[model samples]
Target: MRAISMQEFGGPEVLRIADVPIPQPRGAHHLLNVSRAGVNYADVHVRGNTYLAPVTLPYIPGNEVVGTTPDGQRFVGLTPGGGYAEQALVHRRVAWPVPDDISDDQAVALALQGQSAWHLLFTAAGLRAGERVVIPAAAGGVGSLAVQLAKRAGATVIALASTEQKRHVARDLGADAVVDSTADDLTDRIREAARGPVQVALEMTGGKVLQATLAALAPRGRLVVYGYASGEAATVVTHALMEKSLTVSGFWLPHLYGDRGALPTSMEELFQAVRDGDLKPIVGKIYPLGEASVAHSRLAARDHIGKLALDVTR
Candidate 1:
């Protein structure tokens, strides 16, 4: 088996494709022949040693993947690490069958991002019909799905993206309003689009975007912070919460699956949505597993849109 390993965290150059033994499944765990592995911002954070969770040196990096078990059961789920390889072992209970309508690439991309978007809108934010929601980075993997899920929940979506092209993509994804965050006065544009403060905010970009998102929330509104893509984390202003009577919560999808006992139900709902054509991940780029370094470089450069995948078997 070939896997991407990093002896030390620093840059993309630290990733190397090397031969390694395939891992065996234990207990109820199943060994998957890795077909596609989703590359997330968290992967880059892990590779750069910026994530709060510590990583051991010479470790394989990947979180969510889509493949099959020894018996040929197609599934998607999270791995502790070590998914950037030819094969991965994961708990069978955590993995869900991929829908026939979804390709291997789409399944891998949705395993994490799609689930996160669903959980954030339905569970964490408690979004309801006719409410207005703002989704930052609406062109990215999770953001794209968030836009669709918000619409399905009957919420009017205000999508914030970095470029006009991405804004157009968000519109096509079902966002009622699209704002270019790269342009000056994003807060103003959001206000104009929504006609007032938004009821729910799906925030992934931190720092200035987080602050701006907080400022854009309606009274008693909720803002779910999922990632820090700005390369800088943001601090919440207590005054803002006090003034607007707003709620701010952080969403980590793995915690719900690992701790809240919601994996099975969540996966079921997401797969059903995909099968019904209500949800679909926007897969932007696919790279061979050996080109893990190149993939990381593209992510770091912010050149690609939506989810990037590693074709492990290729």
Candidate 2:
């Protein structure tokens, strides 16, 4: 099997393709023939050694894969490691049969980002119909799905993107209004779009963006911090939250999937949405397995919208 292995923590250049022995199933894990792998910010963090959990050297970075068994049963799910390879050892419980209506590339998109969006809106935020919600980075994988899912749940969504092109993508995905986060009047624009204080904020990028979104929250509102893409720690003023009765919390996908770790019910709903054409996972770019380093560079550049994937078959 050929895999992209990171021998040291550094830039995308560290991801080198190497021929390695194919892994076999151990205990509850199953051998997976990797067809496609989702390239995410999480992978970038892992490669740079900046993730919340420390990463061991000389390890494969991917976590999500769409692939099959030797018998040709196709599945899409999370992998413990080796997802960027031609084959991987996947936990049996995390893998699920891919719906016939969905393509392998699309299924790859749902593996992590779809699950994160579902959990962010329903589990972490407890979003309600007719409420106002603000989502930052709304044209990216999780944000794009969040915009669509939030709209489906009857929430008025204010999407924040960095460019006009991305904002247009957000609007097409059903965001009620879209704002450029780079704008000087970002907070004001968001408030105007929502027509009042926002009830739920799906915050990913930290730093000044987090500070702005925190100030825009309504009384008794909920703020879910899922990612710090800006690479800056967001500081919260408890007194500010106390004055408005606002609440703040953080969400991590791994923590949400407890002991048994089976794919949750929300995944089923998300897949059904795709089958019914109510949801679409955008595949912005696809690179061959050997070009893993370039994929990482594009993701790190942050100019692309939607999901970036590795085509292992190529």
Best by TM-score: 2
The residue-by-residue lDDT of candidate 2 on 1-314, one tens digit each, is 78998899999899999888888669976677889999999999999888877788789889999988888988887875679999988777777888788899888888899999988999889999999999988999999999988988999999999999999999999999999898777778889999988999989889889989988889999999999888999899999989999999998887755535335587798888887777888988999998999999998889999999999988
Model 2 spans with C-alpha error above 4 angstroms: 259-262
Model 1 per-residue lDDT tens digits across residues 206-255: 87878877888889999998888877878887888989899999988767
Worst 10 residues of 2 by lDDT: 255-264
Weakest ten-residue segment in model 1 by summed lDDT: 254-263
RMSD of each: 1.4, 1.2
Please tell me which predicted candidate would have the highest lDDT against the true structure: 2
Evaluate model 2: give its TM-score: 0.97
The lDDT, on a scale of 0 to 1, for candidate 1 is 0.85
Local error of candidate 2 at residue 160 (angstroms): 0.4
